[model samples]
Target: MESPGRLPYRRLMIYLDRLGYLLGLEGVALLRAFREDGSDRAFVEARIAEIRRLLDTPALAEAGGVTAEPGAVSMAEVYAAWAPHYDAGGNQMIDSEQPVVRSILDGLPVGVALDAACGTGRHTAYLAELGHQVIGIDRSPDMLAHARARLPGASLLEADLHRLPLPDDAVDTVVCALALVHVPDLARALAEFARVLRPGGHLVISDPHLLSAYLAPRKERTSADGRPALVADHHRPLSDYLAAALPLGFQVRRCAEPRRPALPLVAGTRPPESLPPHGAWDIMYWCPEAANAAMENTPVAVVWHFQLS
Candidate 1:
């Protein structure tokens, strides 16, 4: 006779939800008993095994491909065509991460700052409110327009991250959020960031870790109009990103994996001026260069931060 209210039951309920199973009250009580009796691990593992079995079932195997429906527009076209919608969506996402943004900006020195790939100027307005002289840039005029409308006083420029229009060693701090994955050439963009940052400047980059995405279960995948979730061009493995940044003279300062809604934030700084340039090398030399080449032709969004040294 096991008690109905237990931790195992709660764990089981969560597992079932994760597996797309609708559990009744009796099922939940049973799980609770298992948890209270110290059998929670065993029961949870069994549930996971069952889900794996379902994933590999013959009926599911017969479905040749898990392709979403067709006739969907490209990500860039979606952004360009629906700039207002895009801005609204971006603002919504940013609002959810306000705490993280605040944490990143906490105690940061106030001065000239660049919000590279400043989509809809969410972070741009955040930086300006802190009294930093901010300059925001984006490839999409529509996005810039929306950003300008939001932050009327802040300077907005239409430019590419891979080749910024700014002069050498101009900004003291650069903050980029959720923008790097869209860039076609991450290495080139990083190099540009480093070139523009002054000595001892700060660079903060926040994006989803590609390794996490790859490891995440397929069931967690998102869909837009029954289409596979669209990500930016340079989305790549975490290892590739680290290698790209390290060689470019960035010394990682902090790495945070937020729990709520689960996101990865990797913050790093440019090496001191005393350090020699990592030297220019072809980004195409890295793994998946062919894939990157194909994406270079496609329009995508990306953001990054670099401090000149």
Candidate 2:
């Protein structure tokens, strides 16, 4: 039996095998020019060799070395664990999404602003600085604590996005960043945003791009029973966002898909001995060429600027 905190060896092996397959697919599709003679024969040969190496790798065959958390946990627990380092963590999604969301915010006429699911008050602080009467709402108390410390005078509330505590036409702007993916029904949250927004109000939202989530590492957290678990992440296609918003009288003003910059090849060198092949980046080191080809120029996040019609 596998130990409490470790994923089973068979499961880990399956992950490694899939990684190899991903690399092989990328080589055929995107890295064809790099393959020998750029021929179909060369691509098949390369893939076969890589598959052999993966099947024979001794480290991947062994049991109990993998320490990745398994199973899904609630968002509250996930953010509770993430609250302390959320702002400081080098989150690529935040890095890509923030500037675009802020640029939209900068153009809007500032008034009563609501930062729904405002983890750590990152955007709340910006709205306050922009001279708006800002209200930051988040369900996680731990996250709210950080926001309170960051903006002492800001009205910070612990609430869910499906039901905003504000009255009708309460705010002129609503900024929700990197939080909608956790909610199951996009329409409900968008409806609440519309409810509290005045006519002609703006709603700016940012979500981790659907394509990026396929390659990105899943967030891990400890469950109530102390077992390792994955944080819940729901994927909403771009069309779903539009379907949810348009019916609610939201007009699409602007949309930006910020692409991830290409990364240098790291296939020749092994990953650090101290770091095991658990997460996406670590596993990518096992086949860096494929990782680069698969991820290059992919959109990191989708930012939307919508005005209530």
Strongest candidate by TM-score: 2
Task: Point to the candidate with the largest lDDT.
Answer: 2
- Give the per-residue lDDT of model 1 (tens digit) for 135-231: 9998888888899999887789999888888999899888777777666567788888888888778787776545333322223122455544333
For residues 10-41, what per-residue lDDT tens digits would candidate 2 score against the true structure? 34421223344444545543444454353366
Candidate 1, poorest ten consecutive residues by summed lDDT: 275-284
Q: Which residue pairs clash in candidate 1? A: 8-35, 9-31, 9-32, 179-302, 179-303, 180-303, 182-301, 197-307, 197-308
| Superposition TM-score, candidate 2 onto the true structure | 0.83
lDDT of 1: 0.55
How many clashes in each structure?
9, 0
Model 2 regions lying over 4 Å from their true place: 1-48, 63-71, 226-228, 274-277
